[model samples]
Target: MNPIDPQLPPGDPLVMLGLLASAILFAVGIVGFLSRRNMITMFLCTELMFQGAGLAMISYGRQHMDLSGQVFVIFILTVAAAEAALALGLVVLLYRRKETLSAEAWKELAES
Candidate 1:
């Protein structure tokens, strides 16, 4: 039996709500990322944005009753996991080198 019910979409209220949530999440992330000066804060914001995108995909998939969106979300999650791991490692390395987590400190590295 097919798991996903084929829902004809003139409009699904749930889907609309999900999309709205996704947009809000992405917007908040963007604003946070832009405003934060700390490396860790910036990474958290980026992760938030990634989650927003994944939510959007899930919402879209539900609207269309297709598995493709869910499939993409799986990939998105995979990438997010890898990104978080790498970001943590980079943050640790950079912090040890600079003794500070501020994004502005990167400019000093450019001069060398």
Candidate 2:
């Protein structure tokens, strides 16, 4: 089936597959973010979640024969780049303070 048919019949298997894959990616990211304590690990998980969101958007846009998803993806990529820079700075400062990347180390900063 052509993916951009503009009128995908209901219960399109390809679209459903795309949605499932996106959901799995998002779920893994959430799990990683919640279970990991390392600052860099959490940042990576957040990036994973962003990618999952982008995939979902793209899948829906393709299903609807629209280009808005590409635009949103560009925006998402820009934000992700900014986020990476900010995370890098924060990680450097955090490491300098304690020489560790664990989130638990942040409590010292909060208490002071």
Local distance difference test values of all predictions, in order: 0.91, 0.90
How far residue 112's Cα lies from its native spot in candidate 1, in Å, is 12
lDDT of 1 by residue, 4-111 (tens): 556854668889898999999999999999999999999999989988998899999999999999999999889989998999899999999989999999886685
lDDT of 1 at 49: 93
Residue 95's lDDT in candidate 2: 96
Candidate 2 lDDT over residue span 21-58, tens digit each: 88999999999999999999999999999989888888
Where in model 1 is the C-alpha error above 4 Å? 1-10, 109-112
**TM, every model:** 0.86, 0.85
How does model 1 fare in lDDT? 0.91
lDDT of 1 at 112: 68
Error of 2 at 19 (Å): 1.0
**Model 1 error, position 1 (Å):** 42
